[model samples]
Every structure is written in C-alpha cells, then in structure tokens.
Target: MNEQIHEKLKEIKQSFRLMMNGVASHSMREKWVAYKINWGVPIPDLQKMAAEYGKDYELAIELWKEEIRECQVLATLIMPAEKMDEDLVEVWMERLRTQEMAEMLAFNLLQHLDFAPALAYKWIASDRDMYQLCGYQLLARLFARGMEPNERGINEFLDQAHTTLEGNNLPLKHAAYNCVLSFCELGDEFDVIAQKALADLNIL
Candidate 1:
C-alpha cells in the first residue's frame, strides 16, 4: 500500500518535473514555479493525496520535499488538518541534519503547528552550519505565524538571531526579516519586542 502511495506520488513528481523540464536542479525548479504557477493549486493535489493516505503526514512530508519548493507548498497545505505527532516530528527533524535538504524540510515543518519549539531550538544550536540556519528559519516561521514568541523565547531567539547574522548565508537575515515582518503586522502588541530585536541585532 505504501509502495502504491509512493508510486502515485512519483508519477505526480515526474509529471511536474516534466512540466518544468530543463530545470536542472531544485533551485531552478523553484524559480520556475514561483514565476509560472500559482502556489494555491498545489494544495488541492496535496490534500487529496493526504486524505487518500489516511493522514500519513510523515509520508506526505517526505514525498513533498523530494522536489523542494513544490514540496514545501504541499507540506504547508497539508498542515492545517493533519499534524504529525511528536515522534514523526522528530523523524522529520532528524532529516534536517543534512544541510543539503534540511532548509526546505525545516521550513515546511514549522508550518505544522504541532511541532515543538524544542525541536527548532535544538537545531538552531546545532554545530552544523545550514541546520543552524534551518533552526532559525523554523523559529522565524513559527513567530511569523503567531504560534510562538513569548517573551523569554523571543528574547532567546533574538540573541540567536544576532549570532546568526555574524555567521553566513542569507537564510539568517531572511529569517530575521520574516520574524520582524510578523511582529510588525501584530501592530503595537509587538512594538517592544520589535524594538528589542532592532536594538540587539545589526540586521538591516
């Protein structure tokens, strides 16, 4: 049954891949999809697949990220109804240890409200460079979604965000921008927090 599910998913992946044929890599595919397709369309396909599999979110997550951006959109859509349990979240987090794919997975996992902050926090502290970025990205997504961001946690994340900027890649900066963007949208409620974030970080 699982094999059947995977086969069906592969067929879809291949079909989409063909639609973007000559896209040599995931990044190219992302750019093409971002420019050409409406993200909203992928959800119905994802939801249909999710329901067909009886809420096997883990499988859906795995299949979704097999192609990165398309997978990320699908994973985000899959989150509202069927959230993965803690154990499966851990499995997903473990996959984030590999820098090559972790960023996309971490981004997707944060969309699912069931994920524990500890999972994201742990990866933020990890020695692996990109996983650290993934960690920050997850936290940013959570903060952006208004899921977490209590004082102490937000303060801790602020400190990490500062440290992150001192590191490399655009991921950390993007994460901070996303968090502040969310904070700004919350109006005066997050003014003090946003002020603290600006004060503590060199982020532009």
Candidate 2:
C-alpha cells in the first residue's frame, strides 16, 4: 500500500479502537457466530466516519483486507461504487464471513454496481449460503431503488425462490422471503405472483 493509504487506514483503525465496546462486541459475536472479530462501533458512527472520510477505493480495499469486522464495514461504507467492478465484487463476496457482512455489503456497495443485477442472478443460483443471502438482499435493494428487471428475470427469480423455500435451509429461506417481499413491493401484478409462490412453497 502507498503511504497515504497506510496513514488513512491507521487513522480509521485508531478511531475504531477508541470507540470499541467490549460488551457490544461480545453480543455481536453471539449474534453473528461466523464473525471472528468485532470492534463494536455502531452503524451510525461508522456511517458518520465514512461520510467524514469520503470515498477512497484504495483505502477501502486495504481496510477490507483486515480481520476486524468493523474494518470491513468501514470498507464497504467508504468504497466508491464507480470504482467497483465484477472482479472486485467477487473478491469481496468471497471474503464475507457472515450474513450481517453480506447484508451490509449489498446495501452499501453491491447494489450500486452496474453489474449488480447480473451478479444477483448468478449468486442467487449459487449453493453457497452467503452468496445466496447477498444476492437476494441485493435484489431487494435494487427493487427499492425502482430498478425493475425484465419479465423473464422476474419469473426466473420467483421460480428460484420457490425452489429455495421448499428446502430446509433457514438462512436461504429468509433470503427467499425477502426476495419475494421485494417483488411484492412492485405492485398488484407482482404481489399476486409473490403470494402464489409463497403459498405454493408453504412459506406463507
């Protein structure tokens, strides 16, 4: 890393360390068992810090390489969506260790990517749990932003969600439910389809 990036990272880490809460960190670990490190800085505080620091693609990437959970969250917040691409998205997705991280990544960064819709489809089809979670969450975020997929894309997503709901995987089931909810938010046409799919899968 360059000197500027290294200095920025040090500053960010210092801020996180100063704000760390041991009790909150322990609670977070219990809630997200997959995450091994937690600085326990709150989301609002992280957002404020990110806004203050502004977007820094190189610094974000370096922060993401750290083991601490808060660092990863900071990375997502500070990352410039304009700098994001398929390769970097894939790398970050693979690095995600928990559903919370995946959700944060989707909301803060992935949803802004030009390739998000295509990636959502591909990741939703994956067998991996984290990828599936991120995919569905991204789909929901996209819908909220009024980005509509084509008819065929909608059908494929509903079909996949139906199949996923039939399985016993709780995490994936939650993701599928959220995906259906996003579709429902589209209007009566999509609401009917979402309702039927939920009923058919006994997820209602």
Best-performing candidate as measured by lDDT: 2
Please give the range of 10 consecutive residues that has the lowest summed lDDT in model 2: 195-204
For candidate 2, the per-residue lDDT at 182 reads 79
lDDT of each: 0.56, 0.85
TM-score for each model: 0.62, 0.94
| Candidate 2 backbone collisions, by pair | none
Quote the positional error of residue 195 for candidate 1 in Å.
2.6
lDDT of 2 by residue, 1-204 (tens): 999999988888888889998888888777755555688888999999899999989999999999888899989999999999888887887788888888899999988888889999998889888898899999989888877778889888988898888888888888788878877888888788777766756654
Model 1, 135-154: lDDT tens digits are 76676667666664677766
List runs of model 2 lying over 4 Å from the truth: none
